[model samples]
Target: MTTAPVILDRAAIDAMIGVIEGRGHRVVGPVVRSGAVVLGDLSSTADLPVGISDEQTPGRYRLTARDDEALFGYVVGPSSAKPFLHATGVPVWQGERTADGSFATRKPEAPTPVAFIGIRPCDLAAIGIQDKVFLNGYRDGVYGDRREGVFSVVVNCVEPGGTCFCTSMGTGPRASKGYDIAVTEVIDDEEHWFLAEPGSDAGQEVLAQLGAAPASDDERVRVENLLVDAADRMGRGLDTEGLPEAIKASMESPRWDEIAKRCMACANCTLVCPTCFCATVEDETDLAGLEAQRVRRWDSCFNEEFSYIHGGSLRPSTYARYRQWLTHKLSTWVDQFGEMGCVGCGRCITWCPVGIDITVEAAALAAAAKEATHV
Candidate 1:
């Protein structure tokens, strides 16, 4: 089926806010926070970061103002799309009276419906990768429930981040699917508007309320050009041919030792990664020992306890742990799942305490493999 693209002016976006907020769902989007763009609760179109950009490097981050007011200027920040799917600091319990003398358990509260606005294409791909882990394999009830009531509005990247390599990963620069509505911001001498395309029935309903018209062929061409340009601007790429086998074969390679010496074993990478699904469950009781509750929190493989086995930690050394993480993400992940674990969002590269880059590591491994083959 063919539907004409629509141009959503600033006023049209405001109308969309009314349409969305009028439905009783709170809108979460990008906003300027402490000199950086962060996802938070937004009430109006003006609440978005209009003219700002971010500079991201391994172990460092900085935000800058853009020449023109562009709402989606920045790429991504420390926050991933996970928080929207899996809530943090949720109250799982409340005190209740018990028959004996202690308190009883109360049911967990359900998360409210949320509409995520201005989600990047790479982030959308990351969310899809996570869906394979949580929704496809195990079908987590919490995730399923949260996902059922949520809506996604993705924004196409006009400029790629320095660390970004989504094009190499075949994940982005343009959003082909996964969102309820996909939008590309177009700015020209005379106009600044969003080219909107509805990807689902819900998106269509929202579009109907926004009151947009069919886009011209020139407008469609402009959007395509923007995506292609962004894709070409990617700063990093990975050579994934035989990556899994190469990583498995190089299990005892000296690269691990070299990496470990520079690595600080911090959990920053996992924390920023949208596809990292490791979590731990904790059970806690009140001071009176009457009421108790169980909670699930985000976990990281960088922790020594992550690989604990019967006797002790399987990966006791930092080298072993680093190897396990990189190999799992780039190589073994594809073997376990049909698709690659990473979406090339560059979060790991940007947030690593030691500035360790996975793409560089993979390339080194590939080079080493080639040299060995020749030998």
Candidate 2:
């Protein structure tokens, strides 16, 4: 069953918010705070980043005010909806002393329903990658349950940031799927509105509650032009043809040494990445020693302890850790999950203290290999 594409004017924003909240779901969207566009719990359309946009490049991010008040005027932020769906720190279970001194364990409570608005396309692609890791085969119950109740509303990128390479990754300028609803905003000197299409039953139900009209022909054309302009403005791209094989072949390359020289092994890249799902568990006990709890926290391969097993660690050097992080993300991840782990959102580039661009490194390795073959 298909719901007609609709025009969502500024007024429709309130209606949409109302419908989602009325259903007892927490609505999360992009909001400007502490000099960045970040995901925050929304009470109304006023919370969105109005008259604001962001500028991003490798190791750089700044917010700039726009002439117009377009709701989703910014590109992606440091974090995505990933942290919400896949928790960074989750209580696994609590244990108490039993009558016989054995521990009795109880898991944490289930997640409540959540509605996401203002999610971008590259992040949507990353969410798809995470779905493969946490939801397939031997599943992660916490991440799976958190993801199941999400009412996702995707916003197509009208202005991709400088570091963004979703075009090269074939993951963006627009989100084609994986959301309950998708929206594209078209703003001009005179008017601003969103062209929306429903992608699921929940999306259709929300639309039915809003009483929005079918999108006009002029509005549809505006959206087409909007996306085309966005594609033109995208600054970076990765050459992914033969990428997995090329990355594997570059294991012996000198690029890893170069990366290690600049990389501090701080793990900021993995922490900010939407698709990186490495986690570590810890058990804590009180002074009385009668109760204990096991908790899960997001972990990174950059940590020295991550590769530790038995007598020593597998990735002992900074270079080896960097190599594993990049190789697994771009190469072995395809083998493991049948999809590339990176969606070209470029968070690893911007958030890194030294600003290492993955696309640049991947292309350098491939080009070096091609030149060697020619020689």
Candidate 3:
């Protein structure tokens, strides 16, 4: 069902703030921090990152002022939505032993309901890919409990990043689904407003409270054009047509060795990746040896210990580990899940300590496969 689109002025957004605040939920969105746009808790419209834009590259990030006061001034940051849902340093298990050797256990606290505003379309797509691993495959109760209370208000990308390739991944520039409400900002000398569409009943209720006017056909056309323009500005892309087969064929290719020499094995790629889901559990005790707890943290296949088995590690060499990571992300992930593991957000490209690009790697493999086929 399609609800009529609405044009929301800045004043109308303030009204939305009241609606959310009245419902006893905190609002979090993008704000300027250390010369970059970051997702954080915000109280008012003034707290948003206005007149700012971010420039991201491997091992470098900077924020610049924009001519217009656009709320979503940047593409994405190093952090994704994962930290909000599955918290770091979470106490998975807490217990105390009795004198009789019996033990008492305490459950972890649940995450509070959060209303997230200004989420980008590609990020929303990344959340969907994450759900495939957390909710679909394993049905993680911790992630599920936190995700259930999330209310998302997605914002379309007005400016794509230099490493962004969401268009090639069929993810975004425009958010088609997975959000309660989708907003496209329209800014110019004369007009500064948002064209919003509600995808859920909660979103419709929020829109109704905002009292925004219905958008004109011309305004809708303009928003669509903005999305198209963002897509056209993409600076990176991957050809996924034969990616799985191509990656499988290139297992013995020399490209892996070249990359391994450059890779630092710092696991920054996995940390920044929106869909890399490997994790490890740890148990710890206090110094006095009175109490103990178990925790789970994010783990990466790049770690040398990740492939450890009974006798020896399966991926003993850096070349093998790098190959495993690239293959799992672009190739075997499709076989394991019905969809590609990556959303083309380019976080891996930006956060790699040595600036190793997955797109370039894919291109090299594709070219190598073509040459081998010709021979």
Candidate 4:
């Protein structure tokens, strides 16, 4: 069930920040750096990307200044909630052998509590996908601990980037879940305030601390109109009605070869994707050869060794590896997690050096399947 929202002018947003930090949570949110919105440590409202906007396309990203003071004028960039929740490189556990020929292992201390601010709906859905992977029967202690204490504040996108298609995925333009507080920023000629709503107990408590007033009917109407405008503004989309079946049917298509011609197997797509969970482990020893540390690092299916077995790799050719990645991400993932692996954040499209858009590839798969049916 949804709760009625409250209104907060731009000034009160800072108070909301203080409320989260007051609870000892390290606030992590978007910051403008190197001409793009990047996630980093945040202290106050000034730390947000104010008057900053971005232009995103396949294989390109450029940041431009907005005329107004709208903090979240742009949509998501390459970064997601993935980094803070699951570090790219983490030490799983370390061990040392004593003189008595015994071994002792020690796990790291629990992660500091994190408060993720300015999250978008699609990325929040990506977080949910990861939860099923990391918190299911076979749990990941590192990711689980970091995920447990997160205080999430989601912001609805009033405008969509050129590569955005969360609407096609049924994930966004408006925030839905996995957030404590959901806010809609409305900056127009007459008003410049946020329509804020709390979705959890912590959110309610924090919102109360901000001393916000009940949202007016006009304010609620403005918020709804913003979402509708965003939906129409989305420039890209993927028709995913029968995506899993389409991918399964298009395996023999020559599209794989076409993609392999351009894909460098750089693994940028997998790295930027919020839900790709493949990782590799390494064992390192000190100069004494007695003390050692076990390191776990994020890995990608694009690597040659990713599909290695006793005899040989499951996918030896470049085309085979690329196909495996696409198939798993769009098809087999649904079988394993009961949902599509993609959350429509467009990170893969924007970050890919070759501008290999997943939506384009998905459409090609459907065309290939159609040709096969005629054959």
* TM-score of each model, paired residue for residue: 0.94, 0.97, 0.95, 0.97
Per-residue lDDT for 239 in model 3?
A: 90
Question: What lDDT is reached at residue 112 by model 1?
Answer: 71
| The best candidate in terms of lDDT | 4
The local distance difference test score of each candidate is: 0.82, 0.87, 0.83, 0.88
Q: Write the per-residue lDDT of candidate 3 for residues 217-322, one digit (tens) a residue.
A: 9999999899898889987889988888899999999999999899888889988887787887789888866678888788889887788889988988889888
* Ranking of all candidate structures by their TM-score, best first: 2, 4, 3, 1
Worst 10 residues of 2 by lDDT: 366-375
Q: In model 3, what are the clashing residue pairs, if there are any?
A: none
> Over 4 Å off in model 4, which ranges?
none
Q: Candidate 2 — which residues are off by over 4 angstroms?
A: none
lDDT of 3 at 57: 73
Candidate 1 TM-score, true structure as reference: 0.94
TM-score of model 2 vs. true structure:
0.97
lDDT of 2 by residue, 219-291 (tens): 8887888888888777788888988888888888998899899999999999999999999999889999999
